[model samples]
Target: MSRIWIERLAVVLAVVALAGCATSKEKLLTHDDRTMLDIWNQETGGPAGSGRASRELLDARQALRRPLTDTDVQTAPGVQTRYTRTAQNEIYRQFHRLPNPDLVMYVFPHLTGTDPVPVPGYSTVFPLYQRVQYALPGERVEDY
Candidate 1:
């Protein structure tokens, strides 16, 4: 067959397919004004057995259901008990600060810079580590 004839045939086939789809969609959309209850009644047999199947199904479901106790609902995953954060755990649970004891240092009296003047000493406290350390997710970190 010629290329032109093939193109015309393809266009005709497309048009026929589109027409078929439109008719089918129209038939599906055109339904009688029946309420949901009427449709449900027809599905289970007839209007005489309306709500009988629904009641039986609900009763069976209720028999399977059980009462939930206090243990059913739990707090956050890692928490065994609930309490206010006081010391190290005060920080976010994800990045817990590792224990680092504070070091007390005393600066002795010394000469002033650029001048021959005497300066009194003072005491200061700083963490043992220069930077605050954090424990990893699964690492064992003691909470006191």
Candidate 2:
């Protein structure tokens, strides 16, 4: 019984070892597999043949050269207004300047400490601009 068990264990170990040694035959391509030119050439009839450009592609390229008509200028009213409003709002924000005027304060000569030391008078300056405030969503701007 011990001999049979040892033989079975050895067989199992051998199978596991052999399984780890197995490798896939398929190889991964490190570079680009296929390019547009290669596909075009294949479809046209291999590398030896000249690939003719499709008519639809040539027509689309020619269409791009044509000048825009008045009909093309007229888009859907909703889309047009939305785009215009966005552009105008952006321009307004770019040119927007908040009034951050400077404020000056004068300090009078005063006494300090328990000994009462005299301090000279001096003036200090600061900007009146407070913290930046933004309007919340759905809130209307009463003043521009």
lDDT of each: 0.75, 0.68
Best by lDDT: 1
Q: What residue pairs are clashing in model 1?
A: none
Q: State in Å the error of residue 57, model 1.
A: 2.0
What is the Cα-based lDDT of residue 62 in candidate 2?
Answer: 90
**How much is the lDDT of residue 15 in candidate 2?**
99
Local accuracy of candidate 2 as per-residue lDDT tens digits, 1-144: 999999999999999999876855453433558898898777766554233445555667898897768777675564456445576667654233445667899999999999999999999998887765454432543445
Q: What is the lDDT of residue 35 in candidate 1?
A: 84
- Tens digit per residue, CA lDDT, model 1, 1-144: 699999999999999999877767656777789988889778875565346776787789999999766666554433533244556556658566788899999999989878779989989999898888887754745684
Clashes of each: 0, 0
- List TM-scores for all candidates, in order: 0.33, 0.28
